[model samples]
Structure formats: C-alpha cells, structure tokens
Target: MLAPERKANDDFVYHSGLKFALLPAYYLPVWFQAIKGDSAVESGIHILPFILALVVATVLTGVLISCIGYYTPFLILGICLAAVGSGLLTTLGVKTSAGKWVGYQLLYGFGLGACFQTPNMAAQTVLPRNEVSIGASLMLFGQTLFGAILVSIDQNVLDGQLANRLAGIADITPQQIENAGVTGILAMIPSEYHEAALEAYNASLRVCFQVAVVVACLALLGGLGMEWRSVKETHTPDDESATEEGREGGEKDGKVDDGKEEV
Candidate 1:
C-alpha cells in the first residue's frame, strides 16, 4: 500500500494538469526521475511512486508557481523537505524506501501545498501596504505570462515531434499507426517502413524533442539553484518586521502585515 503522503503527492502532481490535458507532456517525467534512481534498474517496472508523484507534484507545482507569489522561499523550503523525503526513502534501501517514499512524497506535498502560495503572499507582505494591489497584479501577470510562454513552447515541441513521426512513416500503414502510443508507436512499424519512417520521424521530432528536453533541463536547473533556508537561518528584516507586526496584531494582523510589509 502507498503511504498517505505518497497518495497526496501523486494527486497534487496530477492536478497540475488541470491547466490543460496535454500539460502531462512536461510534468509526467518528474515521476520517472525518482524511480530511475540514477537509472539503477536495467529495465522493467520502476517504482510506481513516480507516476503518483508526477500527478501530485505537477498539480501542487501549478498552484505554487502560479497561485503563490512571494512565498517562493517557503516553496523552496518545501521542495527541500520533499527531497529529504525522497532521500530518506533512498537511504531506507529498496523495500523500506519504497514504503517510506510515500510519507516523503505526501509530507513534502502537503507541507509545500500550504506554502505554494507563500511566495506571492510573501512578496505582497513585503511590499508597502499601498502597493499590495500592484504587487498582486504583477504577481498574477508574471504567472500568466510564463504560462503562455511555456504553453507555446510545449505545443511547438509536440507538434514538431508529431509531424516528424508522421513524415518518417510517410507510407505508414494502418497497422503501424494503430500500434503507436507515444514511444512504442514508431518502434512498432514493420522493418520495411522502419527506415524511412525513422529517418523522417527522427529528423522532424528530434529537434522538437531536443527542445523539450532543453526546457526540461532548464526546469531542472531551477531545482539545482534551490537551497532551503533552515529555521536557524536568519531571515531578512522584512520577514522579521512581518512577524513582529503579526505578533502585535495577531493572525489577521499577520495577513495585514504581510500585505503592508514584507514576509
């Protein structure tokens, strides 16, 4: 049985696709990364957690990246925790890790889910009270803009791949096309059609796939830059001020403070 945490993370990642049906093109692979364990397995079924995590991670990610504004720090921290969860799993050995990976995945998602919006919230908190509306506008704008850019990039990459694949098998038979899924579709073509189809498909799709890989690589780069600040780490004056103001006023006050000052 999967841990509650794993279930949560998987769901979270999957929900990210609510933005669109095809969004999986980008996020589905995140799941695979965890199971690959640096490609530890030669072949066959890797951990099922990857798929679940992919669903949860992507879903929460959309919320975090799109909805949350200034809370980027907290989100960063949450990701760290998630990594720890995965790390703990890895450390646990295969069976144990497999079992615990769920906790790691869920806690990571739940912990971060609350914080997904923290960045924007933080940004708004940090800004002057009068600037709150402006801050929000900007935050939402950035999210929408990035969404547009990435969506376009994703479509182009996919279109190129499809076009190439179709062209490669210019003489593609009904049988070959029927068997095609994503990866296996091309491989299934009969030997007679394989060469031309591969040439055309590979030629066309390679660039798009390459670009898709590049974009994925860039996303990974963002993860590389993540360094979660621990509780012991000193916060900026803005965060301190936000806290002080929150204490003075209370929870609502904290929200007010977050809106008026920095978090």
Candidate 2:
C-alpha cells in the first residue's frame, strides 16, 4: 500500500509546486537575446531582475513558513500570482519598454520562488521521521521531470514557429537559422529579410511565454485542492504514549484516594 505521505494529496502538492520552478528558465534569456538584441553575457545580465527577485522571495517564503507553520496559503497565492505574471509576460512585444519587462519579470520570479519549494516543505512536515526522505524524493523527482519536459517543449514550439514564419523568405531557410546559432541568425539570413525574421522570432518567443502561462494556470488549479495542514513540529508517537501512561497512573491514584476516604 502507498504510505500516508505518498498519497494522492501529496501528488497535488508536487504537481503544483513543479510548474514555475523552471518556467522562466526556458525563455527569459532567449527573449533577451532574440528580441532585445543582447549578447550572451548581456542576456544573462538582463535577466538579473528575475533572478534577484526569486532569491528574495525564496528567503522570505522560508522565513514566513517557519514562523506561521503553514505553507498552503503561500502556495495558493504564489501560484495565482505566477499565473497572472506569466499572462502579463505574453504581452511583451519587439518594442516593449524596459520598465515593463523588468516589472513583469519581478512579478513572475517572485511568484515562482514563493511556492517552488512548497512540495518539499509538505514532504518534510507531513511525513514521519524515517519517511521524510522518501517524501522529499518524490517531490524532487516530479519537479525535475517537469523542468526537463517543459523546457524541451518550449524549444520545440520556438523552432516550429520560426520554421513556419521563415518558410518563404527566399534569403534563408529555418534550418540555417537554427544551425547558425542564436547570435549568428542575422548573419546567415539576407540583410533585407532581417527585420521580418526578427519579428517572426519575437512572435515565436511570445508563443513560448504563453506556454508558461498555461502551465501556471494548471498549477494554480492543482494548488486549490491541497490540504491546509500546519507544518509545526509535533510530538513523536513514543512521547505521546508515555504521556498517556502518566495520565492513567494519576487517575488510578485519585480513585484509590476516594476509596480510602469512603472507608
């Protein structure tokens, strides 16, 4: 039989927690490079807002959960915010303002960090001492699996969209664009077709962002059904049994005292 900690409800926690962990990883740098015209180093630097926001949010979430002893509320709020943030990111265009992109990234990154570790929290808190590792492993496995799958899917979507858009450009084929590499795409294609190619690439990236939004929504739905249990430390079964024995002994002594008084 499945252990108590390995039940269907735990699956819900894992599923919801896995969605946003790597959602931004797939497209954030790509968007910066393809649309924003940043070099590899510049692209990485441009995504700093999201990374920093995630770091702050993660630390805050850990502290809040430690203090409040409940992770469900954070999980719910985080997933909802992530969904909304991702949806907002879909509005990004070739000429979008820097402020808008930064703000959107902060929102999405914070949301992702707030609940990304919730499944692990659930595992550690809900499982027995010996089973905690098992619970944690389950959550980790789900998270890693989702990360690989979603990122690959995003890449495929980007490639497919680019292929369709560059079909009749006459200057270059989608294969060359893909193989020419991210930085060399413009060099491989004719100069006259560069603007159109860029626009198509931007549109494809938007589609990738849309996928993240959908995943976040699905995670939000899963989070809604999670049980709102506390993560506070509690007594072990052995401690509870010893306390029960002490109470019984006290009751017996009281009964004997009453019998003696009646005599």
Candidate 3:
C-alpha cells in the first residue's frame, strides 16, 4: 500500500499500520516479562535514565543527520548498543525469565525511541526545502518497504513454526489445534508432544528475535553508506564552489585551492 506513493504523498499510513500491528507483539512480551520478573522501580527516580537516553539519542541523531560533518564515534556507538539491546529485549520479553521488568522496559524503550525516528529524519533532511510533500512521500515509501518486510517476515516465521509444531503431533489435527484455545491446545496435546510444543514456541520466538537482530545489523552496517554519501555531498558542493571562485580569481596560473580566490 505504501510503495506506490514515492512521489507525491507521505502519510505513511501503511508504515504506521505496520508499526502499530507489531507493537503488541513487541510490547506485551516485554511488559509481561517485566511484570513476571518483579523488577519494580525502587522509586520514580529510576525512570530518569530512560528519559535521558531518549533525549540524548534524538538530539544526537538530529545533529548527525541534519548537520553536515557531525559524524563521530558516539553516533555509531549509540546505534549499535541501542539496536542490540532492543533485539535482546524482544527475546527476554517472550522467553519470560525472571528479570527486572522496569529496567528492561526502560532499556528497550529508550533504545527504540532513540533510533526509530532517525531514518525519517534523515529522509526529511535529504530533501530540498521546497519539495516537502514529495520528500515526505519518498520517506514513507522507504519506510513502508522496510516496515512491511519486517512484519511479513516475522509473521511468516512465527506462523510457520506454529504450523510445523502442530503437524508433528500426529494425534492433534491441524483443524483441531486451530480450533483450540491456548488452554484447549495444551489440554488436548499428547503428553509426548507437550515438551516439543513448548520448545517449538520458544524456538519460534527466538527465531523472531534473530530476524529482528539481522534487520538492525543490516541498518547498522548500512550507516556507512549514508556516511559516505554525506561526505561526498558535502565535498562535492565545496569543490564546485571552490572551482567557480577560482575561475573568477583569474586562474592564478593553475593555483587551485591556494586561497588566492579567498580574497
């Protein structure tokens, strides 16, 4: 739905729909894991760290994307840590081990808030000021491509695992399993398959995390491409200006970049 409007619209309805659809999958698992682990805030004071991280990430991305030559190791570091932490949070949430819920939520939440807006911001900054609408559409086209792919891949992997697990249990028909509630499925499962069913679910979830990590890793690696492009754009403009000025400076007998043009 979002792919066609690469030129004129940028509402990102498809992208936003994809985001919200996956939010429940991401949020509930983390929320439950946190609650299960009994990690309560000692006080409201503990929430400040997440807030700070979120603010810093937004500010840093704004600087790096909106301002030229703002490249530094900190941007790379923040992106890596935040992406990996977000991946692990998905794993931890669904796996449901006893751990600090609030702490984990803050870690993952801040990581998400920090990086989620960066790409759109980059797309926005890349556009000329006059083409805001077209630029927005382009941004959403890109966003939709990635977002749709992510949700599709995750859903496919999960659903495939569920189906495969059901198939292995000869006693339970596919229709039977589908018809059954979580309770009914558990109750109807042959004892021999119970452990395997459980394992399949956990494995499916782990696979989902693996897929998400791969996405983040791809983006992280792709940052280099953005960096190269930025540097090239910055230098190209400077070079063009310098050449024009030097030509106007009467060529100085091939004295290029010798500040003769500066005066």
Candidate 4:
C-alpha cells in the first residue's frame, strides 16, 4: 500500500502541474486578441507553438520514462522549467514581438508536458493492480477540480484589475467594460483610452502569469516528496502470481515423489 503522505504529495504535484498547464489556456487567446489585435481564429493559430511543443514533449517524456524507469527526476525538472516559463510569460507586453511569445509558449508547453502524466505513472507504481484505476480516477478528479478553481481565480483577478485600472477613464463604466469582456472591451472604449486599456489588460494578464509562477514553484515540494521507486524495479501482480503457481506445482511434484518412495 502507498503511504498517505506520498499519495498526498503525488496529488499535489499532479494538481499543480495541471493548473500550470491550464491557466495559459484561459489567458493566452485573450492576450492575442486584446494586445496583438488578432481575431479569435488567428489567436488560436498563434498558440499552435504551445500546443505542438506540449504534444511532442508528452510523447518524448513517456518514452524516456519507460526506458529510464524513473519519474521523480522528470517531475522536478519539469516544475523548474515551468516556473521559468511562467516567469517569462509575465514579460509579455502589448508591443512584445511574436518570436519571444512563441518561444515562451514552447518552453512552458514542454515543461508542462514533461511531468503532466508522471503523477499518474507514479500512482500506478505504488498502487495495487486492481486499485490503479481508482488512483487514476482520483488524479483526474483533482486535475479537473483544481483547473476550474484556478481559471476562475485568474478571471476574477483579470476582471478586478480591469475595473480598478480603468476606473478613472471617462465615458466608460465598469459595467460596460464587464459587458464588453476582455476581447471586446478595447473596441468598446474610446480611441484615446485604447492604450490605457491595453496596458491594463497586459498588466492584469501578467499578474495571472505571476500567480502561475508561484504555483509552479510550489509543485517542487510534491516532486521532492515523490518516492524514487523505479518502474522496472517493481514486479507486476501477474508476474508474482505466475511465480507462486510454479512454486506450488514444484511442491506438489515433490510430495508425490516422496509418497512413491515410501510405498
């Protein structure tokens, strides 16, 4: 059985990694539309680098873990990389170049991909075969739960910042801004206030990223708590059962031979 403390640690790392991975999904598109003036479709295209990197890294990490038979290292390294990437994202601005944003997204995506599945893998390693499904379900539940909570927090942060920063601007009320939403607020505001509005959006988004950085760093605690058990070092239930069966057959044959010799 897995220790309760270890299981908690695994869940923590899993939840944090998932939050780090998901927070960007909520803000990046809005950033593109609000700051870069890209349409919804274009914003989606702009984030392709992040998506591609995540996919490639996830596959690569799985293969490497399978070969190396250790996961704790990846969890630590991934959190470190994610923290750096989240920090970099805070540097994005209205005038920031495409190359920098793309690079940052790639870095963040790869970092998230590296450790995203590792918690589930660790759960399987420590759990009984029959209970592995339950462990996986719990991990997924935590991921979904934390992902929703953090995204909502990010939205609230963004909304609150917008309300505070754009408060002094004439001809635009907070209600109007709220109704306009992140992508439409700029369009709704007067032309002169465009720069201020964009700055507000950028700064607010930076705060969200800063929050992500803190979350990523906190994930390290869980990573450190993870047991260094190797996948290859553990025997499957099937293997143990087969070994037992063989031993039983050998013992039965020996008893038969002893009975014949006595007769």
Candidate 5:
C-alpha cells in the first residue's frame, strides 16, 4: 500500500528482505572453497547446516506468524540475530574450527529465514486485496535487484583483495593468477608462501563476510522502522466482491477514497 502511514513500514520490510535473501548465497560457499579447501560439491554440502536451518526457520516462522498474528517482533529479532551472526562469521579465519563455522552458519541462516518472508506478509496485510499481489511482487523485485547488485559488488571486492595480496608473492604473475582463477591462486603460489597466500585468501573471504555484517546491520535498522501490525484471517469472498463493487462504483462516480466507492 502506498498510503502515507504504511510507507515507512513497507520500505523497511522490503529492504530488510533484501539482506536476508542475498547474504549466504554470495559469501558462505566461497569461504568454504577458498579457506577450508573444500571442493565445489563438498563446499555445497558443508553449507547444509545453513540451508537446513533456513528451511526449518522459514516454516517455523510462518507457523508462528499464523498463530501470533503479529510479525514485527520476528522481523526485529531476525535482523538482530543476523547481525550478530554475521559479526561472528567475520571473525572466521583459516584456523577457525569446523564447529565454529557450522555454528555460525546455523545462526545466520536461522536469522535470515525467520524474517525473509515478513516483507511479503506485511505487504499483503497492509495492501487492499486487489493490490496485495502487486505489492508483494514489487517487494520481491527489490530483493532480487539488491541480490544482483550486491553480489557483483562483493565479487569486485574479493577480486581486488586477491590481486593486491597475491602481488609480489613468489614467482606467480598476475596473468597466471587470473588465468588459473581464485581457487587456483594458492596452488600457483610457491609452497613456502602457502601460509601467507592462505591467510590472504582468508582475509579476502573475511571481507565478504564483513559485507554481510554491514548489510545485516543496515537491514536491522530497516526492520526497526517497521510498524507494529497484526495479521488476521479476516478476508472472505464476500469482502472481496464488495471491494470489487466499491472500486467499480468509485470509478463510475469519479470519486474514490482508498479504493472504496464514494456514494
């Protein structure tokens, strides 16, 4: 809904949804492959903790929203947890334990999942029945746009970090590094500098996670802007038909207020 009172809440939920949707998709697996020395398949597998946690949290949040009627608390809680989780993830390094990574992923995933659906839910709640679909779709479009733009920015950050760190290390040239790719950069470096190269790669990946932390914090701020509102199962076919009639009548009368026909 574009009503003045609902604008802030709508904007907050939509932007926050962007952070929850994008972070893990861009950062976690790269961290696994580069820092943890995992193969593509293995890296994907290792992130199961996060994926599974997200799935569970998504389902649970939907159930809770249905039961509780209010989703504001969940949005606030999710962003806070995500920010904390991202902060913890930023501390990861080459020597970070498997347990720590898994735990951190779980935390981040659950946080993301808990509020990922809130934007659409809130949009549906505030929008008129006829406008709900359009409102929800617009929110999703913003989320997708954020994902595309942020991931590209993240890739540039990581690539720049690697190029700077890998310079002047052993006999490896930038050409060879670029030709071989990110994962291959370590192998191209001399064995003596492996530790340094590993640390560099870790540093780069850490930067990616750090971006997630910053985004999550911003998302939290957005979440905090959301209005407190309850969702209720009050819509019925009769109400929808009446609303449609109201719109038609409004159009005929050349007078409408908030989608209701003026008589």
Candidate 6:
C-alpha cells in the first residue's frame, strides 16, 4: 500500500496543476478579446492551438505512462515546463504577435496536459482498489475547488492592478472600471486613453501569469514528494481476488478428477 503522505502530495500537485493550467485558460480569451480586438468567436478560434495542444498532450501522456509504467518523471517534467510556460506568458503585451502568443499557449497547454492526469493515476496506483473511487473524488474536489478560488483571486488581481495603473486617467475611476467589466472596460474609456488602458490591462494580465508561475513552481514540491512506483508492479484488489478464486476453482476441479479416477 502507498503511504498516505504520498497520496496527499499527489493531491497538492493536482490542485497546483489545475490552478496554473486554468488561470491562463480562463483569462487568455479575455486578453484576446480586450487587447487584440477579437470578437468572442474570434478569440475562441484563436485559442484553438492551445486547446489542440492540450488534447494531444493529454492523450500522449496517458499512452506514454501506460507503456513506461512510471509517472513520477512526467509529473516533474510537466511542472517544470508549466513553470517555464507561465514565465513566458508574462511577456505578453498589446503588441504581441499571433505567432508568439500561439506558441506560448501551445507550450503552456502541453505542459499542463502532460501531468494533468498523472496525479489521478498516482492516486489509483497508491490507493487500495476499493478506495480508488474516494481518491478520485478527492482529486475532483480539489480541481473544482481550487479552480474557482484561483480564478477569483486572479480576477481580483486584475481588478486591483487595473485600478492602480489606470488611476492616472482623470476620466475613469476604479469604480467605473469595476462596473465596466474586462470585456467592456475599453469602451468606457476615452479613445485617447485607450492605449494606456490596454497597457494597464496587459500589465495586469502579466501579474496574473506571474501568480501562475509561482503556483506552477510550488507544484514541484508535490512532484518531488510523490512516491516513485510502477503501475505494472501493483494489482487492484479485484484482480487479486479474481486470481485467487480462479486458482481455488482449478484446485477443486483437479481434486474431483483425481477422485473420479480412483473410483
């Protein structure tokens, strides 16, 4: 059986991964729409590279883990990549090119996707067969809970940063910006201040990404704490029980055949 501490570490890593992965995923569309002047549909379209990369990486990670029978290395590598990607994301600006943003998104997406499922795999590998459901539930809870909390925190960071940076503009108050919402904030500002507002907004986004970088880096602790165990070395309780039952049935049949022969 895997130690409880290791399982806890897996949960921490899973939670951290969700934060770093989701913070950018949630906000990038806003950035595209607000700063890049893309429509909602266009922003969605622009992020397709990120979505595709995540999907491919997720599937590839699962396949590789199954084939390699180990998950710890992926966990470590994924977190490192995520940290690097998050750092790169902080460089985004109003003038960032499509190619640069797309590349950064792909890097972040793959990094997040690579280790996204491994924590659950780790839980299953470490927990008892019957307790797998509980372990999975815990992961799910952490994902949902942390995702919501971190998004709220990022929103606050964005709001506060916007207020602070845009305070120089005499026409717009923090209250007005708060009410305008990110999508509509620029429209509320005078055309002359639009450039400054975009800069402030972009800087605020950078701050959010900076938070993601820290969160991703903290995940390394959890990754290091995870026990290095092979999935192939472990059997579920049901599998063991089935094997035992099959062996007993074979023994019983063999005894009956011997009795028939003696008779």
lDDT of each: 0.42, 0.74, 0.49, 0.78, 0.75, 0.80
| Model 2: per-residue Cα lDDT at residue 180 | 73
Worst 10 residues of 1 by lDDT: 13-22
Candidate ranking (TM-score, best to worst): 6, 4, 5, 2, 3, 1
For model 4, how does the per-residue alpha-carbon lDDT over 38-156 read when each residue is reduced to its tens digit? 89999999999888988998899999999999988887788787788878989999999989999999998898888878888887776656667777887887787788788888877
- In order of listing, the candidates' clash counts read 33, 0, 1, 0, 0, 0
Error of 3 at 190 (Å): 5.2
Model 5, position 138, has a per-residue lDDT of 73
Better of 3 and 4 by TM-score: 4
RMSD after CA superposition, every candidate: 14.3, 6.8, 10.5, 5.0, 5.1, 5.3
Q: Runs in model 1 with CA error above 4 Å?
A: 1-73, 78-115, 171-263
Q: Estimate the TM-score for candidate 3.
A: 0.55
lDDT of 6: 0.80
After superposition, candidate 4 runs with Cα above 4 Å error: 1-5, 236-263
Off by over 4 Å in 6: 236-263
Q: Show the lowest summed lDDT stretch of 10 residues, model 4.
A: 254-263
Arrange candidates by lDDT, descending. Answer: 6, 4, 5, 2, 3, 1
lDDT of 3 by residue, 1-263 (tens): 12222312322332232233233235334233222322334323344445565676667665665556343233344456555565665565334543453555455445555455644443343333344466566556766676667667666675676667767765566566547633355567677876666665555556666665555555554443332234224333334555677687666554456645334
lDDT of 5 by residue, 1-263 (tens): 23523644555444644554456556788888877888999988999988898899999999999999999898878777777777888898889999998998898889878887887777766556766677667776777777678778887788777778878566665566558765887777788999998898888878877787777766766667676767885673444776888789768886665766455
Q: lDDT: which is higher, 2 or 3?
A: 2
Candidate 1: RMSD to truth = 14.3
Clash pairs (backbone) in predicted model 4: none
Per-residue lDDT of model 2, residues 95-182, tens digit only? 8999998998899888878987776776666555656677677776776777677778777788888878777664566577668777
lDDT of 6 by residue, 120-150 (tens): 8887886667677878888887788888789
Q: For candidate 1, report its TM-score.
A: 0.37
Candidate 2: deviation at residue 153, Å? 1.6
